[model samples]
Target: MHEMSITQGIIDICEQHAGGRRVLSLDVEIGELSSVVPDAVEFCFEACSRGTLLEGARLNILRIPGRGHCLDCGTDTPLTAAFGSCSRCGGYRVTIETGEEMRVREIEVDE
Candidate 1:
């Protein structure tokens, strides 16, 4: 899964920033639309963190719900896994707001 690779990348970045310090925790924001499975990512975290500064680190995943704005009706609606479609006005043209992000929101480490 790509989440494994992504987890590895996060560990790499954390290791670079930690500078030999022990990683206490990692706060990650996973968007619903990002297609990342929280359980799968968490499962891979331990493997990815092996021998790194983030080894045995606590991984905190914050789920960010998908949000969208209807362009035709200007209605803000919660997005489902389905394609772009306005829930209020039934408009087909919808602008996605947030919920497509996957990023390391914060990282905690021990000095």
Candidate 2:
């Protein structure tokens, strides 16, 4: 699954920022529209982190809701998908403002 690759990327980022210190925990932000499975990422993290600096690191995921602005109605609305219709106007002309993000928010390292 893509979560395997995504987990590897997370490990890479943690290692890069760890600076030889062992990672104790990681705070990750995954948007609802990012298509990245949180469970899969958690499972992959255990697999990918084996024998690595992040072997026992705790993974905390923050799920962000999808949001967009309706161009036709000029109103901000919550979106469930990438191309969701505007809630206010029921129009397809919506500009997504967020919800396609996957980033490492914080990394806690051993002293």
Candidate 3:
């Protein structure tokens, strides 16, 4: 899955940003459309973080909702998944508003 690569990237960032500190916990924000599988990422972290500063680091994932905007109704409405459907009006040209991001929101390190 893509999360494996993503997790590797996160570990790299942590290693670079941790600056020789031991990682205690990592909080990541994953959107619905991020295409990341939490279980797979967690499983891979155990192997990817071996011998690294984040060997025993805890990974916390926060899931974000996918939102879309209705073009016909001119309203920023929230829809399910990637389907761009308007709620107020019968339109299929709704634009996405959120749930397309993957970022490291916070990190805890030991002093």
Candidate 4:
């Protein structure tokens, strides 16, 4: 699974940004359309962080709802999938505005 690689990237980010400090917690945002499983990532984190600075760091995940702009209706609407039809006009010509987000949002470090 790519979650392992992603978790590794998170560990790298934490190490690079921690700057010799002890990381206490990490917050990440996962979008509905991103296709990244939070549980899988968490499992990977536990494995990948072993013997590292983030060995016992708390992981906080924020889920972001997918949103799209309907070209036919000129309205922003919620989407359950990347290719979901717009609610206003039942149009398939919707452009994704948000969602598909996978990134670190915050990190807490011990002084």
Candidate 5:
């Protein structure tokens, strides 16, 4: 899975920022529309963190819901998919406002 690579990237980032310290915890935000599975990332984190600064680190995953703005209805609505119809107007002309994100929001390291 791509989460293996993604998890490695997260670890790389954490290690770079850790400044030779051991990571204690990490907070990551995964958006619904990002096409990345949180469970897969969590699973990969354990394997990828072996012998790294993130080893045994607590991984906190925050799931972000998708939201969109309807161009036809001029209303904001919840989106479950990337190309979901607007909930209020049932229109397909929806522009995504959020939920296309994947990022490491915070990291804590032992002093």
Candidate 6:
């Protein structure tokens, strides 16, 4: 899957910031609506990190819940999918507030 490439990207970011230091752990954020599977990423991390600074690094995945604001009902509700209906009025006019993010949040490196 694409997680291999994504894992490589994570390693690249860690190496860039680690400055040749060995990475001990990493914190990554994955949104519910982002469609990037955390398990897949975790599975790929080991294979992708081999021979890199993140080889033995522990990966911590933070799952973000999806949220949306309904324009018709003026209500904020939890969303489970990309094109989800509003909970209040069951309206389709909804704007996403969060849960579309995928990024590396923190990195711990060995001194």
TM-score of each: 0.93, 0.97, 0.89, 0.97, 0.96, 0.96
Clashes of each: 0, 0, 0, 0, 0, 0
| Two-way lDDT contest, 3 vs 5, winner | 5
Residues 49-95, candidate 6, lDDT per residue (tens digit)? 98998988999999999999999989998999999999989998989
Model 3 TM-score? 0.89
Runs of candidate 4 with Cα error greater than 4 angstroms are none
Cα lDDT of model 3 by residue, 1-111, tens digit:
777889899999888889999999999888886678778888999999999999999999888888887877788776666775777786888888788778888889999
Off by over 4 Å in 2: none
| Tens digits of per-residue lDDT for model 5, 1-111 | 788988899899999999999999999999999989999999999888999988899999998999999999899999999999999989999999999989999999999
Ten contiguous residues with the weakest lDDT in model 4: 14-23
- Show where candidate 3 strays beyond 4 Å: none
Error of 2 at 63 (Å): 0.2
Query: What would the per-residue lDDT of candidate 1 be over residues 22-88, giving only the tens digit for each residue?
Result: 9999999998888888898899997878888898999999988889988888899888753767889
Worst 10 residues of 1 by lDDT: 78-87
Backbone clashes (count) for model 5: 0
lDDT of 1 at 41: 87
Provide the lDDT at 99 for model 1.
86
lDDT of each prediction vs. the true structure? 0.86, 0.94, 0.85, 0.94, 0.94, 0.93
RMSD of 3: 1.4
Model 1 / residue 9 / CA error / Å: 1.2
Relative to the true structure, candidate 4 reaches a TM of 0.97
lDDT score for candidate 1 against the true structure: 0.86
